[model samples]
Target: MASSPLKTICIYGAGALGGAIAAKLATGLGEQVTVSVVARGAHLEAIRAQGLRLWEAGADRPLVARMTATDNAAELPPQDLVITGLKGHQLTAAAPGIAGLLHSGTRVAMILNGVPWWYFHRDRQSGHAERQIEELDPNGELWRRIGPERVIGCVAYQGAEVINPGEVELSNNGRFILGEPSGENSVDIEAIATLLREAGVNISISPRIRDEIWSKLMGNAAFNPISALTRALMSDIMQNPALAAMVGDVMNEVKAVAESLGARIAISVEERLERSRQIGPVRTSTLQDLLAGKPLEITPLVGAVVSLAKLTGISTPTSATILALVTQLDRENMRAAE
Candidate 1:
């Protein structure tokens, strides 16, 4: 496949994942492709004042990537590619601004957790697909605005966190798996994959992105909410045999739902749980969001699985219970913040 030249790339929501991506792209692809970031508050200020400072997963020194930084999306030029690092819950709100970065040839790559709004867009079957997950996309704003034609499905396996303003610490350096919403290979998709690879990001272009989504979601659906409710890291939860069993149950339910939807998750539940234990004292993204007083990515992470269970007519009692508990925790967290 011939690789097309990438003129410009913009990363929306330059937090952990976005910042880590920006750092690599700006530093590794310097002058090869134009890199810019859309961030806000002190992080934006620091990026503007200084370059993005990134401590790569296992490095002694941090790397500084100087690139364009702005809070105003309107200020950015039309991009060849726009990678949205915002959580599923945050996408609709940021949809309009994200739209401004698009041109006719631009591709929007979403690298977030759990089920995406585009899950059923082209990957739909007769009675199983959802036209709208109201919990994830209220009022169909993202669907109407961004549309599914321009989407590039990306599953980011990497774990990173913004330790402070203008700085990101990568805890895991995993491959980014990408595919088209319609599950077709294209020159544009190949181009984006090549660009990321050139920029030192481990990348894979999947034939069935949904399978990849579920592969990651199975773990996220179990780990994230459990960590939030228990206020524990992956290590802490796995240390307790009872908690580990519960996590296993949640994962099994999710696997059932995924297989019902015709998505194959090759990894066994035991393997996923074991991997979680090996990750050590890592805080799940949901826990981090709760601790920061930010909105929870609950709907897509856990609620989506429960919704799928209903669609598949499968009973997910354990998943439902955990979803209920976590949803309330999120509601209370939001209420208290207000």
Candidate 2:
């Protein structure tokens, strides 16, 4: 069968990950693809005034492409693919508008952290089908607006940050794992994966993406919240025996919950901890959220595990304690800001 021509790709958030993807697409795919970004505030303004700039290693490059950007989805044409690069909480806020940007065949790839809202639905044998994660989606907004079928799970393994408006600092890692909800290989999946690969991303189609999701979630579940609450970097968290053990406890609990759901983690807890240590002096997204005074993704990142533990008849005492401490700190931070 002949492959369908590539359609325009719109990256919704245009943050660090989004910007890197956009730059790579614009550079590699060129006119073969139309790239647009949806963003707001000073960043959006800067991108509009001056083209998006991407800096990697020691080189800076200004990508010259006529990309569309807007806060409103109504300002653009119906998208064939919409890559959501927003944080978990940001997705809920932008759900309604995002729904308006999609047509029937549109695929919405979620590239956020923690467990996705559609995690349970993708597991057929699991009893919790179409389960709504209230801590993440709250009020069933994302569940209703963006159906699970339209979702393509993406796990980003990159460390990029926006240094200033319109410019992003690219990190050493730039790989993305893509998978379908049904875990089947399809034309649409191949098309998107090929486009991403052509755009300079190390893209792979996984038969068991849920397993990969949980594996990554294990690290985020422990490192992110703990880092935020303690205001420590990854190296410090891994070096301190006590903190590392606390992280280990959280991971062990999460591993139980994941196994209960039939998602077997390939990596051991000790190996995963060593991997974190290898990442060196990296600041987790949770710590970044805390420092930026943005809302921390505690509910989806940690609370969802607690909810899953309840569903699976498992206990997660350490995770529960950490969740409590982080929740308190987030609330206090919000209160002080208010």
Candidate 3:
């Protein structure tokens, strides 16, 4: 679909990251390219009423952009490119609504954290070809509905949040990496990357998307759950000698699992840890979710790691313990919120 025109785009689950991206696209892309966001509750109403406002990282003022904001994706027309900013736990419920915005050649670019639902699709070397990742998708909902064939892998590197209804705040000048599961520099990937670039998004198109997923998973699997459990930021966790050492163990284990599955993580565990530590005092997604009383996105970040470790016959004691603890934390936190 190289010749495919990206005239219409939708941001599914326009929370923090999605809202930030949508705000940029709406203001950056002119009348020629229409950007719409699918949000819910008070956020949607605020966007409808006062437009989506974004405060760039380190900015004093917010940039407001007016575009289509709706609760139901069916209310909008079929989109050409749908970039999802939904968290791990929200996709199943939003799958149908997301599907409603798809046509024949629509590409669903998932800018989610941790392992994606389509991680096993077309990834034969993982020795789990087309196998269901029940940790990420307990049912076959995402796989059956939004077939892996239509997915465009995206790894987000920045932080964004919905500070208030209809307002998004950026933690940094975040960038995104996009690729296809088949590792092809296909037309769809190029088109989407170019469109995002045109909208002032720092984008990179990579062929080894699975490798990228594993690399990012290192931090998500380790720092996120640990941070939530301890209520500390990445820097804080890495500063303590014992916690930092535990994080290193988790990253190494995750690396072993990825290599066993045929994905190469180029960097060493120490380097990854140092890089994460340098990111300073930013709160991890898991930590933020915990403090906000939202559902903890556990499976994709850590549970999936344990599931894969078992598949690869690799021992991940630290990761396993963290997973068990975080899983229960999610349940108890959710219940308490209720």
Candidate 4:
């Protein structure tokens, strides 16, 4: 007899990224894989009541998967893979609740932006190994609860958002890079990659996932905070030579830190900035968070780099200054919200 296929995979934070992945899996993988989503508030109700609505490629479509939406995680079964699409800060809030959903062999793929909580674990030569990012992790709850060994790093390049409750709009780019902490090609990693690739995501199993993480981080560290602080789109920020130059300085400092950690970025600062420019006018998620009145994820995105610089004996003056400014900005924003 044939073996039973992978039964259940949950997209824990079923926002834009989660919705897209769920819809694709429900469509392509069908009975071979079971897709469930975990969400809250109107989004959760919408998915439960009306199924998930996806808008992509200039067409509106809906896929009704065997989804479960609950603010609680104990209600769900142990999952084969739990794809976490929450922002770094949001993960902290939900970590305890979601801990029960993981079995011993479960792979928790973190699809967040900036530096993940597990960054230093995979980085053998990084001086910051075993050092916790207090600003991001806060109380070391995530590092303690989840542990780095269970993590599979994912760098999401897709741009998407929820157009309405239970509905998502895919803007462009649906690529996801996956790798293990030890950079080995394992069966579990490939299985997860296969599911994602079948779901229309450009999934690549990278040998040097740290390089990809830093490459993406180079753009995020500059563009995200700058966009949030200035309230400008990508094209507008890149067009202003002075502002663009300021971003370049931050990138230079970050590159130095990466090199010191033994992960040298192949692209120059200017080339990376140009790549952002070519993406045209786009509002980063940090800017979106500010507008949405959500907490700014500055610590993981910027502060982690600054902390890593200190560990590696490198100076990140530019990143340090920008981080300070963004922290103040986030504080004021939080006060206003209160």
lDDT of 2 at 302: 92
- The 10-residue segment with the lowest total lDDT in model 1: 123-132
The estimated TM-scores of all candidates read 0.96, 0.95, 0.96, 0.94
Clashing pairs in 2: none
Candidate 1 vs candidate 2: the TM-score winner is 1
- Per-residue lDDT over 81-107 for candidate 4, one digit per residue giving the tens place of the 0 to 100 score: 888989887988888866877888888
Model 1 TM-score relative to the real fold: 0.96
Taking the tens digit of each residue's C-alpha lDDT, what string does model 3 give over 1-338?
23338999999988888888898888887776889999889999999999999999889999899998888888999999998989878999988988888899899999877878998888856778788887677688888788899999999898877789999889889888998998999978988887788778999988889999998888888888999999997788889999999999999999999999999999999899878778878788888899989999988888888888888899999999998999899899999999
Q: What is the clash count of model 1? A: 0
Error of 2 at 163 (Å): 1.4
Residue pairs with clashing backbones, model 3: none
Q: After superposition, how far is residue 149 of candidate 1 from its true place, in Å?
A: 0.9
**Could you arrange the candidates by TM-score from highest to lowest?**
3, 1, 2, 4
What's the lDDT for all of these models?
Answer: 0.88, 0.83, 0.88, 0.82
Residue ranges of candidate 2 with Cα displaced over 4 Å: 1-4, 57-66
In candidate 1, the residue pairs with backbone N, CA or C atoms under 3 Å apart (3 or more residues apart, or in different chains) clash, namely: none
Candidate 1 residue lDDT tens string, 129-244: 54777778888888888877889999988888889999999987777999987778888898898888888999989888999999999889988999999999989899999989
Query: Which ranges in model 3 have alpha carbons more than 4 Å from their true place?
Result: 1-4
